[model samples]
Target: MPSLYSAPVYWNEQQYLLSFYDPFTFRLTISLYIAGISLIPSACSAPGCISNYYPDDRVHIFRVPENPPELKQAWIRALHCDNIDRLKVVNVCIKHFREEDVEYIHKVPNGDGTFTSVPRYKLKLKGGAIPCLLPGCPSYYSSTSTSKRARLSYEPKEKEMLNQTIQLLSKI
Candidate 1:
């Protein structure tokens, strides 16, 4: 029988290992060998699963550019809106940091009151920007504890807001 195991794998052109199991009477193959294969997967967003993205599941970090005004605002809005998840909305806390005129930062404060440090991911937001950095998103919906039981839900405008934001990022 053939099985697959997801282990932390690393490789070079000469030798490589993959997710397939040990072979008692069979062989294995890897998709790529031209380039060194990092032990990690490119990403794990669920192929077409599109539950959006979970904050904690942020196994990898991404950076966004700030040269263009439209894209900058859009990326921040998307992160804030919790549009990463299709199941439910969890508004994010966005903080746009700047050097008076350098750039912006749309931050989702973690338990330690610190923002993620993804290079170039520091973003800027316009005054009108709203955030979706809710307590639970991209995964768990609905409140669990008494402290946060949001009677409110994802609003209508959020759809358009999140779309416009990502579009800006995709372009440049």
Candidate 2:
């Protein structure tokens, strides 16, 4: 009544009866399973997009927004024209938040007199803060309640490229 993997006698008997053991297939299957398991943590939980590669500089996966729906809507509006599917995976980069909205972790001395802090500086953004009005990011700036004419209005193009990249990632 033992399982196939738990019963070594069964495996030996099967190998003896077949006179062959496909170790390569077994190992390949095991390695594939392990690799798939390793990717689970990186999988995007966004509704429509299932991307796994979120580059550090370009994509900052903020903590999922609160339940009120205003935060998500604001992010979408700030990022400019949006489809629900694109909004599903919309994440803001550090550029989107005002400097004041983000909290910086300070260096402090530990009890033994050793300074302990993040190896690299990290900023924590508050949950309710909306995306900031960046001067050059047309998507953000124009979306803001500001003047329409921007000398450097290239964010629409950037959004297109970002969309293309996301589409490519999803296909992969």
Q: Report backbone clashes per prediction.
A: 18, 0
Error of 2 at 163 (Å): 41
In candidate 2, residue 86 scores what lDDT?
43
Model 1 stretches with alpha carbons more than 4 Å out? 2-4, 7-15, 20-33, 37-73, 79-172
* lDDT per residue (tens digit) for residues 1-172 in model 1: 4455544355654655554553552444333333464443233222222121322233332234344545444444434434344523222322222223223444456898888744345444443232323333453332223221121123335677899989999998
Cα lDDT computed for each candidate against the true fold: 0.38, 0.45
Estimate the TM-score for candidate 2.
0.37
- Reference-based lDDT, residue 155, model 1: 35
lDDT of 2 by residue, 36-96 (tens): 2432223333333333333231333454465556455555555454464443344544545
TM-score top scorer: 2
- Quote the positional error of residue 28 for candidate 1 in Å: 12
Scanning candidate 1 in windows of ten residues, the lowest lDDT window is 143-152
